[model samples]
Target: MGRGPSIEGRKNAADAQKAKKFTKFIREITIAARVGGGDPIANPRLRLAIDKALTANMTKDTIERALKRGTGEGATEQVVEIRYEGYGPGGVAVMVDCMTDNPTRTVADVRAAFSRNGGNLGTSGSVAFQFTKTGEIIFDIRETPALEEKIMEVALEAGADDVLSEDGFIDVLTSPDSYLGVKAAFEKAGLAPIDSDVVMRPATRAALDGEAAAQMNKLIARLEELDDVQDVHHNADLPA
Candidate 1:
């Protein structure tokens, strides 16, 4: 499947966002390789991580450098991958995925963001129980006949759990075990998706509106401003 066409309305904002997002993607690759080894052939997670960077238009030079850093063949600096759990405003559960050279500084920055936003950072496993980590892949939605059928067949054949076409893309859910397989199959079929990541899936979602939603959105914005914060996942229903 191919993207139908670019949406002029959001292209500028998306371009701006991709600049920072690509940085995070690179960080993720570096850390993923560090923890799991630099060879994507031997590391499934790293393979997926690289695919994510590519999806965001990360250049090959940038990615190879990250891998070299991870493997210690190019750099000796320490880069760590850390996950933080917290409660945001309105009792919304949040999972922050981070990459940093200094965990101490990272923690302080995260704590301050939470405090200033009326949220509380919890212990290692405190808020994690509220959500499950799942593989989520999105395809750039296209206008074509037999669209859903095409996506469903590819996803299911590769062990996807479900397929939902909404928000202009087909979202394929899979157990982490099959993520790379599904991704590879789709790539071979010439369907490039927008994004894929291990996301926090809340068991139940809380609906937010009016001032509460506004506050939550603000909190998210502030959290993202922190460079250490790579990906922030929440289970609140709010409109973009």
Candidate 2:
């Protein structure tokens, strides 16, 4: 009894999503360069950001402009990183990371999203203690099972904290300080990851279903739609 999108509608939606992703990628590249300097050789974060942007088909000219902006050349507004903590539907702890030129507007927008979604914003550190920051490298498992053992051995030998295989991928967890080294080791072993990033992992998860699950999904989607929001993390386990 649900209406589906027409072919044209689907194409339009796909285009919009791609545009949104490109915008976010640009923001990330700018921030990383700003914080760590414009030279990717000296800045691992910026290097990672640039790699992702390139993978997304961002033009070289666009990437150079973003780097210039970060280094205060041809810069207009100053952007700052901010983190907002809150609880979403079903009491799920949520954290929103944003890069914005205006903190007041960003906070107001985030608060509005939370309040409208049956949630309330929390004070700093209210929920941050329940999370840990770590480096995560994910590899697609397209080869034989023997590949898993090799990945685990190389990752751990190179300072990885843990290696987990699931959902057709292998995840290598490492301390933030050891991330680069572990990644290099994987590459040396001819095991390139499909994705790699530093992220905050939740210590616990909240199980939600039915109306609560639907509401949580809506809340996350709305938050992501905001231009300034870069990443949204939560400790909710919704039914697949």
Candidate 3:
């Protein structure tokens, strides 16, 4: 009989995963500061990025260094943001957001991930039409009872598009332009959110299961593993 995976191996894998997540968080913080300015108060995107980094237990020194790099105090290479559109297994529309200094290498890595996982790279706007960009703020239901009523009253008044409550959380949606305002309103109301971000949401979902679903998951995981890739969005509705 084959031996089970070693404990040390699992530990190493988990550590590697954590390190990758940290790298992505750092990149986001740096890019946000670079594009929007290093001051969080004046830069809503940077503020969100810093909040996420803090929530993930990133050190203050690490964040400060990234901010310095962003603001040209300790800068080296120039990192630019790019988006890749594609289709994954089972015709699932996919979008990848990346921050890279080398577009050539990033594109090649992304293309290879898609092709090897039974997917195809697409031209710009290929699958972008299938999604809508929106600002989302999520609050834990346990921390905010009567979440729906409270969120609706505050969010809608502040130009939010919708407030949805499910499971143990509430999600408030807003137009990209209204995101900062809505977030400020919630913060001023003393209803601090657990997570907030501007994201691409699928206008329609593609259902996939078994082999197709597995393949799609593999594709997404692979893309996410790339150093330059920041986020991966897809329309595939898999098992919860």
Candidate 4:
């Protein structure tokens, strides 16, 4: 008989997963701080970046060093945030978010990926019009309804478009201009959400067949392997 699902094995697997995720956390923090500033107190984005680092178990020294680079205390490079729009296989529209010190090299790599992966690199704003910017916040269920109630009221008061109650979480959507106010409202209510960021939501979606989904996923994976690539959003919907 073969041994199945050993406990020690599962623990080791979890640890490895955590370590890999921690590396990505540090990278993002470093990049975020480098572009913005090290002081999280004054930089809301840096504060969010630090929160992510803490959640991923990044060490204090690592976080500090990243901050130092941001403030010019350490050897640093200018990392500009850029977004690429493309059409992936099956004519699926995709957008790639990147932070890079070298735009020339990054664009060349991104264009190549699109060409080799059965897609074409699109002109700026080509796919942008297909999406709308929204301030989306993902938070856990608080212990009491007071926090939830306050969040909804404050978000709506601040011009949020909608408030949703998912299975075990709450999502608040706001106009891009009202995002900061809504986020501040959540903080004022003492709810530290897991993540909050600006994202692109599609105006209309184009469905992909199973084969197209697989191809698109492969293309997306290839984009993720690039060091500069941060986030990839696509109109293709994947099965849950």
Candidate 5:
């Protein structure tokens, strides 16, 4: 019954979200360059981070600045990467990856998010065994026998582990080590992926509905809203 958000308010929210995304991208780029080298050609991690930044429409100059900060050519903040494993509503396994300057604050905030959302924080390795790290590339194309065959041929030849067609999308799964190579092969073959990433895939999913599902969604949203949280992975299968 009340008035909805005005256009300016919506625009402001969108702009803020974009800024947050860019900040996260820059942080990832800086860390990758710092861990590896500034040269994308030589540093696979940095190369992937650069690709993501470009795909997100990030400016080259901004990326260069982040690289400089990483390589010590410019001032940089000291941030630590941490992983937190937990369980959300309906006993769904959850994993969170974060980069933060304050570990104490980050942990406290994460724990609170879980507690407030009918979940609880877990010790390291508690929920990690439920997942496997793998690379996944998804193409937003209508499923067809011929198209599936072509995609499978290309992906397999590129060293992908498997190709699957379902729900009008094509999936190319690969080992972590072969992810970059497979992605490059797809690009050369003019197959652009709508989404691709190396992620922690859950082996099993917990089905939730009604109140539990709502709580799980809130838990995820809360974790994502934390400034230091980077990635959130879960094994909750909720109704659409």
Candidate 6:
């Protein structure tokens, strides 16, 4: 018998999502290499980008090509980083980080996504004050005092700001500058984080439910669907 249609559709969607993620990683790597250098040891930003790509299962050859493109060997266009701030449904603060070769096209797409989804794009710094930029490292481990103590001991010793146990994960927060050192420390100690990133964490969350929560989710999905949108940060407290 043939596979279920729903299963096949899910597989296709997953594949598409993975491809999009790879494209974003490549762009980030190329930009990082271009701004800094191809040597990961010498360039912290590029090093982090490459690490993320590797963790995502990006192939070595693909990474090398991105590095070469960044180094201008086969690069076609210059990509620039642009941040768009806005308010989504339920007064939730939203920030969109993008790397694009064309600012005009990116901005238009971003604005349209916001407007069509019950949102309004705002000027720079408008909603930025609502967030704090920090490095977050999350470990998927059962909550235990012993493990929590171990994580705190290692992370704090490595300049981490704080450690928190949330839901089914342990979160280590760090200053942006201390992120690389802290991560290295964890790795050296044989503690591998399931996910880590420098992100704009919302200082406050806007709780929403029913229609507002649904609208907020839709807005975020729309924003993330944009090819130029690399990351979407929001302060919405919706149901999981």
RMSD of each predicted structure: 6.1, 2.8, 3.3, 4.4, 1.8, 2.4
For every model shown, what is its TM-score relative to the native structure? Answer: 0.82, 0.86, 0.82, 0.71, 0.93, 0.90
lDDT of 5 by residue, 47-111 (tens): 87888889889999999999999898999899878999999998899999999999999999999
Model 2 CA lDDT for position 16: 94
Error of 4 at 205 (Å): 2.3
Which pairs, if any, clash in model 2?
none
Query: Could you tell me the lDDT of residue 161 within candidate 6?
Result: 95
- Runs with alpha carbons beyond 4 Å of true place in candidate 2: 1-8, 139-144, 166-169, 184-195
Note the Cα lDDT for every prediction shown.
0.82, 0.88, 0.89, 0.79, 0.91, 0.90
Q: After superposition, how far is residue 238 of candidate 1 from its true place, in Å?
A: 1.1
**Regions more than 4 Å wrong, model 5:** 1-3, 143-145
Model 4 over residues 160-211: C-alpha lDDT tens digits?
Answer: 8999886667899987656777787778867687788778877777777677
List ranges where model 6 is wrong by over 4 Å.
1-9, 140-145, 166-168
Give lDDT for model 2. 0.88
**Candidate 2 residues 152-232, lDDT tens each?**
999989989999889778999999767878988988988878888778888889999999898899899889999999999
Candidate 4 residue pairs in clash (backbone atoms < 3 Å): none
Candidate 3 lDDT over 59-147, as tens digits, reads 99999998988888886568899999999998899999999999999999999999999999999999999989899999888755776
Model 3 earns a TM-score of 0.82
Model 6's C-alpha root-mean-square deviation from the true structure amounts to 2.4
User: Which candidate ranks first by lDDT, i.e. highest?
Assistant: 5
